[model samples]
Target: MRLRFLAFLLLASGFGLSSASQEDSPRIGDPYFHSSGAWGQDFRDQWAFDAIGLSDPYVVWDALGESPSPVIVAVIDTGIDWNHLDLSWGSLWTNDNEIIGNGIDDDGNGYVDDRIGWDFLAGTNQPWDYDGHGTFTSGLIAAEVNNGIGMTGLNPYARIMVLKAVNNFGRTRTAYVTDAIRYAVDNGARVINLSLGGPSALELETAALDYAAQNDVLVVVAAGNEGQDLADYAFVNHPAVITVAAIGRNGERSTYSNWGPQVSIAAPGEDILSLRARATDTLMNITDAYKPGSAIVGPDKRYYRATGTSFAAPFVTGGASLLWSRNPSLTANQVRQALLQSAKDIGASGVDQFTGHGALDIGAAFAADPNASIVAEISSVHVVQSTDGPAAEIIGTATSDRLEIYRVEIGQGETPSSWKPVAQGRSSVTNAALATVSASEFAGASVWTIRLIVNRTGGTSQVTLYRLSLG
Candidate 1:
């Protein structure tokens, strides 16, 4: 129960935010485009792309042949545009068990006949994006790529599951937010993105996040747009969520973006304009100069572009989806750790309030070895007190195909004897479950050396050993 509670706390705390007023300023020029092309036309060639060195973290074009489709990412914000060309392929999870309108709770998770996704704001099945915020956010995360249409998304191949927590007015009640979170977790969302937040903190919201993490769901949230330190506010201080800050094309922190020690990583936020519905396919650049009334009309016939930390959160969420899609075995903690470790350090050396770890380096994260061992290899083995217990767990692998545990004699001040088999089993090549060995056999041996023996079979496998003490 305690472990479960800790897990819940970890998950809830991971949902990341803050809010601030927008000030008018000069618009920064496009950092990615050359003189011959509009940044919008050739944005992929921008320095931001070169600095991060990633082309659509979600596409995985090079890895398509080797990996399976990525996991589903749940966007809990304003509703997404179901008909947007870039996002049509990346809509929410369909409840195939339930019929569209006959009014039956077929799947029985509480909501009724939710064929598409839930709308916590309206408290119904209608989760259409009236404000276009959710649509833009979704587009950044999983909009389809190489369709010869609009802009490519971070994780184009990843599925986008929408959960409308915020209303058309961009306001969400805490209770509704909590319900939406639980719904996402129970329904099979691996990555949950929260782009909306409030000044008030609720225990229910925290608990919902906790539940999601315990269930193996990753929660990515925006560091508040208010440039204030997050340590000063309880609403944004949760530890379970991976809080993200907004950075600009110059690799500098967005002036309007929030800062705090809780921030995990920074991503491109300033001047980012995504697909919004309007008469023509037009883009609205959000910048320091972005005023409250500025809007653009696209084919979908909607207008938007009020920038905040709210927009920055999805990039990280989308990037996580891409990473998780490639490596489904990665836990939420492991994913968070990878993002932090792989980030390009900014502000100060090590972590600080301004930028957390640094700007997120999607290329570094995508290129990382997901199955790398967390434990160090045993060079020299020493048994300090091997009283009355089984032999120490010999952690090794017969090969990439099998995990093998062994029991070996360890003489004091002498070379360890030959390895003797203890337990062996076949797990996923990337072990979803770990191997465990008991230490009851070496009950009274005072001195012994524990050595791990490996037998190469199909491929080289990494093994981890743990010393268990029995009183």
Candidate 2:
């Protein structure tokens, strides 16, 4: 089954289909069948949720009182169903300053009257989810949770900012996507989800991504569904973006998920059924829907089954938004590092081509203390080394005007027991500062560690280890 899916993806790419066709596009249909219960067994299994274990790390949930609200995440895809029940909670903000029917640039952001979001394809603000692809993607990221209907998104409280770059016909141009990205960054979008990709790389897209990085916006892109190495394509080679691969229930790489050093992490994308449009012009439940046997005849009289890494990419994007919203001070690079570091290692001891750092562990990420201090202050230390070797510098600051003393030591390991004193420093004023001995003291192959011991001499004075630099 996986091999056939990969083959299909390869063929789709050859024909210029980015990932999968738009949900509204005409395609194969499944025979109408009725299920006796709620969709699939996987839907009711709490253990299945446990298997994914997607919970926030950094303890942002507890600190923020509620999940981050009104955090804008731009879904740079086809378009979103503005009326989708699951997505109504955190819908895009309309620019009230601009008249919907007027042909004026109210906000003056280049696009005219982009009340909700700009449609680069149509060159308008009416970015409706015509093809249903963006709606599904948005649902994965910020679909309303605990709404007593449909599925819960990773960050249900996050706002879904729609930036339509692809058209209803599943045709997208590189220039459109690039413009969408720039608009997303300029419009206060903290995260940008890119589920569409092609075999060709564009210089404009690269510049747009670079601009996003410079502005501290996190860009989450699919690692492609071709089951091939992304290193072979320059389009997915952006280091500032988090490239997501797809993983199956068995904790293995999805057969259609591309693999390579460029792949940053994996998410559950196999047999996952997200919200899809029914033939009757209503929503349908298609959980655990995979290819071949996973098709369903919607009320609209169309066959639909959700599959591909395209769906998985939004999960990461939504997760990132939740994390960023909770901690607005965190830079985009820091958020990417945190997500990658928190992933559960699957394929190897370190990062691998297939899974990168492994599947995302949201639960672990939410449970861990992101701001917990790992460094402590003592005194400055010095060691002997060659003149050309790397130098070590440690600086200290006094927190109060009263005298503040500190003890310093050099250690062979991370623990204090492995440490030995080499130098010491003391401060008598609040503005006092100190630095470790010169680089000539510690050189060669010896691995030395520095520690600082702070003491209050007068009043309630405090001390800090300000700087630590090693060349």
Each candidate: what lDDT? Answer: 0.56, 0.58
Go through the candidates in order and give the clash count of each.
34, 26
What value does the lDDT take at residue 289 in candidate 1? Answer: 36
Residues 91-167 of candidate 1: C-alpha lDDT, one tens digit per residue = 45676787889888888878897877889867788787766677877777766655644455566466777788776
RMSD of each: 13.5, 12.4
Give candidate 1 regions above 4 Å deviation. 1-51, 56-59, 232-235, 278-306, 369-471
* Displacement of the residue 399 alpha carbon in candidate 1, Å: 30
Q: After TM-score superposition, what is the CA distance of residue 104 in candidate 2 from its true location, in Å?
A: 1.4
Candidate 2's C-alpha runs over 4 A off are 1-49, 55-63, 66-69, 232-234, 278-305, 367-471
Evaluate model 1: give its lDDT: 0.56
The deviation in Å at residue 17 for candidate 1 is 35
